[model samples]
Target chain A: MLAKRIIPCLDIKNGRTVKGINFENIRDAGDPIELASFYASQGADELVFLDIIATFENRKTLANLVKKVAHEINIPFIVGGGISSIEDVSILLNAGADKISINSYAVRNPIQIEKLAGFFGSQCIVVAIDTKYIDDDWFVYLNGGRIRLPLKAFDWAKQAESAGAGEILLTSMNHDGTKKGFAMDITMQLSKNLSIPVIASGGGGCMKDFLDVFEKAEADAALAASIFHYKEIEIPALKKYLNENNVETRL
Target chain B: MKVVIIKYNSGNVCSLANALERLGIRPILSDEPDELISADKVIFPGVGEAGNAMKYLKEKGLHLIIPELKQDVLGICLGMQLMCAHSEEGNTDCLNIFPLYVKKFVINKEDKYKIPHVGWNNIVLNNEVNSKLYLNTENNKYVYFVHSYYVEKGIFTSSETTYIIPFSASLKKDNFYAVQYHPEKSGKTGETILRNFINL
Candidate 1:
């Protein structure tokens, strides 16, 4: 059986790993490459480096940082943030990233997903959806989950899957960093509807949180920041816990 | 030495090249037959539909040269599937080097095990002494895999994995060796597997 994935997302700014509460008030965590290699050694299935700093200077540094991390780690690394064109995907992929993730740009111009998927197979392109709950329904958010859109979370995921996206990363702004648990309602609905793999992001605080998301939400993978970043939860330990919980993991 | 990666309208060339470079080996991307035949090792990788991949290989005339080569040859994911006797993806014919046929996973319907088994899974060695890919790893050590169809468990299977069905995860015959998993994406275990292949 295919093992469920445990992913640790790193928000990068000027070659350093940073974290924030709901995409604001960025605080430095550690060096980007060092933390990435550490996560790989700790048995993370994949790593996602989001270039939160979208400035030109930071973009160049993020590119260099991607090269540094790819040089050391042996797992799949996904690069996102400010990836506006195919050329950007090429540069990051050539620099050693196995896949390139797109968010704001992908929602604005949906054809970019098809174009990227056509050039580089759908497996190499990941479409991330940041969502916030509103009036009993979930709405898609762009620009780091600040601007909520009219399109619902499930609809966007269906559209993205139909557009040939290999995987969809769905993050809940309402539960992000709250340590309550995953957005099981949305994740369960999306996983049931979308044929493609769905990665549950945000609101994981412990091993039970991972188990809850996998069993209840039916997520293919779980992404976390604070729990992994602050050393509250380690990947190998979590995998071990999930294994004990009867979830198939690569342990 | 510049390694010429045979380009036959397939993905995974860049990742293979990157994996090689990690091992201090620089490879070249080439679809030209002469370039491929002259390289140190020929790596054929695919990530799309299986039958169409074989059609592209046959059209390029690389199919004939692939089996006759005395040099090392490796296939990754769909690349490995194309090396078998036949595939059920498009119900197309394959090279038949390993004498195996790829088949679709039959669903129980009552259960929800669907096609395209994606993500990391185990590698259980079928032949302990002859297995090169599973060397240095413990029995049932896991590796990354992504595919809808798999080579049915048979005499040619080197390593096997069990999900909805027990299937061949790696196959080996003389110099022709291939894995249904992506070593480039799998962590240390996959890196060591690729390293063993490059060294072999």
Candidate 2:
């Protein structure tokens, strides 16, 4: 049986790990490569490095950082943020990152997903969905959860699957830093509906929160930023906890 | 050493060359029998109809030279499937290096789960670890994958991945190594796996 995955997400800006609240008040966490290495050592199933600053200079920084991280790390690492085209995906993959995640751009140009999936294969493309609950419905948001799209979160997830998205990273903006736990209803519905692996992102407060999501959301993986970054929960320790709790985790 | 990447009108050879360049390994894109057998490593990569790809392989006499090569041989994506016994796609015949048949996903196309199992999937070590392929990797380590047709779990499968059904993600026999996933694009895991192949 496949063991569930626990992933730690690091936001990179100018080659450093940084995290912000609702995409603001960005504060430094540590070095991107160092932090990624640390997470892998701590038994994180995978690591995601999203270059928060996708500007020209920052993109260069990301590329350089990716080179350094790829040389040192051995686990799977996903790179995203400002990935607009297949060329961008190619550059990142060549830079030694494991998977290229596209959220905003993929939602806009769904055909590119199919093209990249055909050319590079589907496992290389991870479509990250930043969703928010508005008026009794979960809506998909882009631009780092600032702009809302017309389609609902569930619809976009299905669209992503149709577009050849390898995995779906469903993040709830509303519950994201609240620490209340993942929006299980939304993620569970998508997980139940889609055959592709669904990774639940955002809204991680404690180890219990992770258990709650895994038991309820039925996600293949869970991705958290602050909880893991701030040392609120240690990965190996959490894996042990999950294992003890009868969750199939690789400790 | 010059490597010959069999160019039988398959998928992007440019990416393969690009991955080689990243490793500072330059390979020639050639279908010539002489160049192919003489090369250090032969990579057969394709991404279309399996039957047509095998047809071209047979027409160019590559179908013969590929199996008897003493040098290391690597196959990626369709390249890997073509190295198998047969593929359900287009009802194609394969090289039969590994006596396994590729079959389509046994799931409803109408259901939410789609075909072409694409994306990152963990590689479950088949216990019979190949020293050449399964280096510095633990059991159930995730790798990238993208394919519709899969080789049913069998003896030749060195590594396996599960999607709609558990299938052989990689097969290893003697000097022949093949991966159903694109290691070129799998990021760090891809690079390490490729490097391991090169080192092997």
Candidate 3:
């Protein structure tokens, strides 16, 4: 059986991890490569690096950062943020990224999904959808969750899968930074509706939350940031907890 | 030992190169028959469609030489799939290195499993304790896999894994070895497998 994945997302700015992720043993936490190696050593199934820098000049820096992280770690690495074209995906993949995630660019040009999937197999492309609940409908949001799009979240997810996207990284904007839990209702819906894997992102506070998402929502993978970033939850201990609860995780 | 990674425009070659570099073996990536024939060990790593990849191989004349090479060859993921007799992907024929057919996974509505079985999965070693690839690695160690198509279990299967159904996770025949998972992406256990290959 395939084990459910646990992923830690890191925000990158100007070729470095944004917030300092200080742990008990480590001193400095700003180095992206160091934090990535730490996560891999702690048994993280995968790592997602969201390059928050939004300038054309910084793209090369982000690719170089990816190369450094790829050289240091021996686990799957995903690079996201401001990936708008096939050239961007090619640069990152050449820089040693195993997968590339696209959010706003996917919204602006849906055809790029087919093109990317065609050029670089569906397995290399990940479509990230940031969604919000508004007026009893889950609508898609863009520009880092500030602008709402007219498309429904469910509709866009289906379109993405048909467009040959390998996986869907679904983030709930309503529960993003809240230490509550994942939005199970829509997550389950998307997972059930699509044949491709759905990675539930946003609103992960404790080990129990991960268990809930995996067992209840049937998410293929669960991605979290702040809790892991602040050391509120250690990966090895969390995997042990999930394993004890009958959830199949890589331990 | 001069190790050469067979490169034909597949994705993730750089990751494989980096993995080899970590093991202190700086391998050369080439599709030229002369370089491939001269190497002590050859690693065929790929991440692309079966038809397009095979077409590229044929265009470069690698298709004619890969099967004839006598050196030890290791195939990963798509590389493994292309080594089989035939593939359901793109309805294309493949190298006849191993007499097996690769079929797409059929995800039933009742099953909770998704297509493109991606993530870490345990491999039940079918080889003996002294098997060249299983050196320094225990049975049932998890390895990273990312593929929708799988080769059917056959006589040459070295390891087996169950996703929706039982299939060959790794296969071996004489001088050729292939694995359906990405050892480059797998952690310590993966490093051990790569080291074993290097020693071979």
Model 2 TM-score on chain A: 0.98
> In terms of lDDT, which candidate is strongest?
3
Models sorted by DockQ, best on top: 3, 1, 2
Q: List iRMS (one decimal) for every candidate.
A: 2.3, 5.9, 0.9
Clashes of each: 2, 6, 0
- Estimate the lDDT of model 1: 0.83
Chain B TM-score against the true chain B, each candidate: 0.93, 0.94, 0.97
Off by over 4 Å in 3: A19-29, B128-130
The candidates, ranked best first by lDDT, are: 3, 1, 2
Candidate 2, residues A1-251, lDDT tens digits: the string is: 44578989999877778888767788988877778878866777778988876986677778778877766565667889998877788788777776789988888888989998887667667899999999889998888877887889999999899888888999898887777888899999988888788889888888888898887778878999988888989998898898798777755
Candidate 1's residue-wise lDDT over B1-200, tens digit each? 55666788676565677677888988887778888888778787888777667888889898888888777778888888888988988888888888888888776646545345767888878864376766677777778776778888777688889878898888888887888888877787888888787777
For model 2, how does the per-residue alpha-carbon lDDT over B1-200 read when each residue is reduced to its tens digit? 66778898664454566667778788798888999878888887766668878899889988888999888888898898888888998888899988888898878756545555654567877777464677876776556555778888877788888777788888888889889987765555677788888887
Report fnat for all candidates as fractions from 0 to 1.
0.56, 0.09, 0.89
RMSD vs true structure, all candidates: 2.4, 4.5, 3.0
Using DockQ, give the best candidate's number. Answer: 3
